[model samples]
Target: MGRARCWRHRSPRRWKQFHEGCVPCQAVGVASHDGYKRGDDTVMVDGGVGDSDESGLRSIDLATLSGVLRVCDVELLLLDGNGPRAAFASRVHEEALFCSISCGFHCRGRFMLPPDWAMLGYLHATDETLSWCHGVPLTPGMALTVMPEGISEFTLSPGTHMTLMLVPVARVQRKLTELSLRSTPPAGQALSLFNLASETTPLAQHYQQLHVQLGQGASLQPEETEKLLHEHVQALLGAGAADRPGCSRARRTHYLIAQRAENFMRLNLRRNIYMNEICDAAGVSERGLRYAFEDLFGTSPNRYLSMLRLCAACRSLSMADSSRRSVKAIALSCGLWDLSRFADNYRKVFGELPRDTLMRAPAQIGQPA
Candidate 1:
């Protein structure tokens, strides 16, 4: 493949024109022959295969896949050898931004959002037990999540598909005011998971339909998009008012312990990590730490750490300029000093030698590959 190019919106008028002209739908249709079926019943078109400007779907590499809504420090660690293939489709409207994402591998990642924006996410398709957010296992009918602002973590199983909308906090507040509803908490509050199984309000049903349409690669006009955003904001406010309970206490505790340990692991990724240090950082006993890791990631702490380092190394190799970097340097940088052992383990997880990844052309950072 040739070097990928970034999509730049030179001006608002031009960007608006591009989206208003049904360009995204056309792009997806044009690439339909190259499309693949995802578990969610959505088809993902590989539009990023070449330098086509009109292509809406873009292949995402781990090194270049930023946050779903905005640019942030996104660290995606692959859980298996599926080798990092994702496709993204996005549309910008007057009131919000709509995104559909399909991943071909099981992976976990974390990202932070800006305070000005709030996100509503729907799991379009995934296995019942494989998708998780903030340590809570997600179910199909459990539908929506009002993502918190500071940081959100998720684990997506292979073939997991999601549809998300990012709207400005000001817009949500305006909708609430128009509807004569009470003001919501700031965007930086804790996440609120809403279940649609027991009671499906009109607004909730509308939001679900819109999410489904977007996931199926259908583009909406500006007015329709605005209406959808309004209904979603109303639904969120209504859900907030309902006396819905949060996650169980045990689950919450496990999430906190795992999150603390994971944060420390990320900070010290370039050096040796000790279990005692992790336990101390998480303020938990060694057994407690082990239980947290197993509950959250389905792996022992040591094994998860090793996978994290290997994933970091894989991303580095994919993005590094091989002309000036060597496999040894990358391995050592990720704290893997045993060259022979590192190579064997890396191949076992990634299905390729580290040097082979480095030799391939790197995708353009911050752009679709």
Candidate 2:
């Protein structure tokens, strides 16, 4: 991995003014609007720079892929012990936000979309049968959805490349009204997955090209952005009308069971949690729980739970105050009590000991001596 560097253009007043008038910036809580130019064929940004020369994409390597976007609440757990090494980049347009992500390892997570905004995802590449959303397999030509005010679960295989666009619900609805199309369904409806090959293939291809151009440091004019947004909304609604497949009953059951168990583990990470407790919380027998986990996550319950604890410990250590916090405390808090074993496992998963991560944390400001 190349060294990580962050550059800040400290014009707070200018940024504030820009944020006030830019809906996308406000929606995604962008701190600054500084632009990046292609340097040495790598996409460099104001805050972080991507080091990969092959892709020439500006991406930030994140420890935990949470809070990467202010509009979405994303909690991802790496299924494999390998470091997440998530490559993330985004551009906030006047009426939409576009993002591209490529993960280096298998992972699963639940994401809650911002209220009043709809997220459209296109899988640029993925391993066969390894990418899924809410128990439905994802393919290259399918349109992914997490409707406004909706929460969904997803899993990504190693080396998965995805493109995402987030547009406000009101804007899409207005476009539908103008085009004499149906408005969006009421909130809380299950998200729809539809193939985009027939009528909407050109739109999908166009969107992918636009994303590539933007990632390569091309700028979009105001009218051009507006037209792109209109076309995207139209494509989304058209896909909805085409043949779509709903999540099967068996898959939905397994997903819910796994989701409940995972939620229980996350909420009670402060102490040791047993399999029986997890099964009870999920309202399933031990055998049923194991089947559900294996079906959804391709792992046993015990292993997945262990991975969760380790990831939680990593996040805590990465964000903890080094002056006041210790690896032992964070490990115990995440239910890893054996200090020696915890250190070994943490190193194996994160490529560093707990103390090393803590040492790298930014020091707290305004401390009293």
lDDT of each: 0.63, 0.64
Clashes of 1: 0
Question: Candidate 1, residues 1-369: lDDT per residue as tens digits?
Answer: 011122221244533443344222212223454333333222334333323233233334454454344323467887666565666655555556676676767788766555456677666567655677776676554545453345567788877766677666677667767775545633334566655544366554665566556555665654755676666655555565333335678878988898789879988988999999999999999999998777777778998889888988878888777767889999988889999999999877656688877776343233222
Best by TM-score: 2
64-181: candidate 2 lDDT, tens digit per residue: 2564443554667778766655555566566566676666678887666655677766677777467787787777766665665445667888778777766676776677577655
- What TM-score would you give candidate 1 relative to the actual structure? 0.73
Clashes of each: 0, 0
Q: RMSD (Cα, Å) of candidate 2?
A: 7.6
Range of the 10 consecutive residues with the lowest summed lDDT in candidate 1: 1-10
C-alpha displacement of 294 in model 2, angstroms? 1.5
